[model samples]
Target chain A: MFDTQSANFDVQGLSVALIQAELGRREGGIPIGSALISPLDPDVGTEEVPASGRIYIHGHGRNQRLQKSSAILHAEMDALEKAGRLAPEVYKKATMFTTLRFASYVHKCMCTGAILLYGIPRVVIGENTNFKGEEDLLRSRGVEVVVLDNQRCKELMREFIRYHPEEWDEDVGGSKETSARAS
Target chain B: MFDTQSANFDVQGLSVALIQAELGRREGGIPIGSALISPLDPDVGTEEVPASGRIYIHGHGRNQRLQKSSAILHAEMDALEKAGRLAPEVYKKATMFTTLRFASYVHKCMCTGAILLYGIPRVVIGENTNFKGEEDLLRSRGVEVVVLDNQRCKELMREFIRYHPEEWDEDVGGSKETSARAS
Candidate 1:
């Protein structure tokens, strides 16, 4: 149902990412989303982009309860899995669009490792989260990284955190015993 | 068979983490590995730790080719998944031991998110990879983290990178076209 024929891949990809984030919120999951677009052929000419030349795969982060393995399912990982299944050959040429800015090494290593393994060439994120050399690392590895701020995507993440106060609480030291007792 | 009776939990946990890393290397996967030990009951007394008071679960990173969904499975995620299935009740009290030092946010966010969600209290890594505030984030969330360097674990990871040079190559720009042509 998406406009696959659009030459503006970024526009289409961001729209898909936003929709997926909203869907995740509605499904009681993390409000993070990713959209991966298969590479466009250089020989095809950029004027009239053919729908067949590109594939769109979108995914949203899932809560631990919704996962069969009870592991946190990340939006980028979900989209990457789907892309791998749908198109392995052109997957490496894919451009990934994500709704959140990564701020931790765990997320950077895991997702960057996958992106590099699959040879994804470009990544677009919604806003910056004080990225510290992560963008440089990606660039060094030949990944074109872009940060494009989106108001709606920011609002969705804010809402998700608002709803899940316990999960995001920073006063974790005082609550450790409480959590242990509750468990 | 591991000596689970050892009162030194760190020694036992590190040994398990190392073994898992070796297993991954032998299985043609990533050399990273993780071990999760369920918390010892507070009343059990630390001097003579009972076997029934704790549980150990270990896992290794898997290659994308080995996965049904083609997702790159991190050692931490693998261990977390197994712990969730084996013992959901006491999983919150788990202490995670990992063979590698994470250097990216992808790994940090994914692994940290799961740890927080499960209410895991402690984490131990083999070394530090110039972590930038990620450790602080974890500590702020009430997680205790320790870095204990190990020679064999470092050797295993080095060998993994040596064997898979293309995967870790920093000059990814020149190879993009070549990869596209080969595909």
Candidate 2:
């Protein structure tokens, strides 16, 4: 069983990520979303915490305009970029929460280097998949990994696949292009 | 023994990459460099081929300005970005050349996902290292990988280490930050 009461787990951060994922899906973008919560966040009584030490960011997948091949930006990258820009100091002490497993997310877009570069210590994710090897790689690099397996997160991923079947397939199995396609 | 005379080998592209790497090192940037050559490039007689279908790009490692954590850009990503912006159609059919082996390069910066996203067919690199697993992963994804043990490339990497020992260590081992540092 998963321990939601773990001291390192941020339930509120996961809640915010779910909201961001739903918003992204409704906006016709990739449903992936990320949140970075600093340990300095002021503890509020209710579930609605102020946005002082929490950052929510989301983005679409590959840019079709760039010949449908450029994964111009991604949600996790966006969160890291924004947090790095906004509060560089606070984010270093931050815990990352996302709708997808961090390993799967990094595997899909290759942001593992950036995450390691940023020195993010802990990651709390909502889904789990066959990316256990990638997760182990991250762990070996010293980043703490946690999976929540939230039901809403799974639903959002399912919905994202239903809406963008082709992209989901390409994302799961890295895009394979034949030499003839280059001509 | 490495086959320099292979039909797919681009000796000229590797030569250009060496020039780029040297220039980058002299400019106080990371010595890594990347070149993307399109199959449609016009064959020139001499080693000095025109830059019509070849794009050379290089960059520094982590942006120290961003609290010494953000890997703002990298050579391979820069080459891909520039090529994707300049000739989106042509880049899809392009082969990448770099001073560092592609697997080591991607492992250092996590650009594997971007390379796969861009649908590049082949990669020709100068140096090879312990990133054989990463190289095999790329091969499994259908990208052709080649290693050319160019002496100049190895010299440049050694020089880069002599100049930026700390960064080189961080790049290879991946930055490991303790929770205390984050505070």
For every candidate, what is the interface RMSD in angstroms? 7.4, 5.6
Summarize candidate 1's per-residue lDDT along B6-102 as a digit string, tens digits: 5667767877878877877777766677877764442233254445644545343432323333343557767755544333234455678888755
What are the per-candidate TM-scores when only chain A is compared? 0.68, 0.67
Can you tell me which runs of candidate 1 are displaced by over 4 Å?
A1-7, A40-52, A56-70, A85-91, A104-109, A116-119, A129-142, A169-183, B1-33, B38-64, B67-69, B84-183
Q: Best candidate per TM-score, number?
A: 2
lDDT of 2 by residue, B1-183 (tens): 112345535676777667767777776665777776664332222344344533433222211211324343455655654443433334445677887763334433456655665566788887765244343556776788888878887787667666665555444333333111211
Second chain alone, TM-score for each candidate = 0.68, 0.67
Query: What is the C-alpha lDDT profile of model 2 across A18-136, one tens digit per residue?
Result: 77777777766666777766644322323443444334332222212213343334556556544434333334556777777633344334566556555667888877652443435
Q: What does candidate 1's lDDT look like per residue over A1-183, in tens digits?
A: 434456666767877877777877777766677877764442333254445644545333422323343343467766755543433335455677888765311222345555654567788887554343343555676678877878887787667556664443211212444323222
Candidate 2: where is the Cα deviation over 4 Å? A1-8, A16-27, A36-72, A82-94, A102-109, A112-121, A129-144, A169-183, B1-9, B15-23, B36-72, B83-94, B102-109, B113-121, B129-143, B173-183
DockQ of every candidate: 0.16, 0.16
How far residue B39's Cα lies from its native spot in candidate 1, in Å, is 3.2
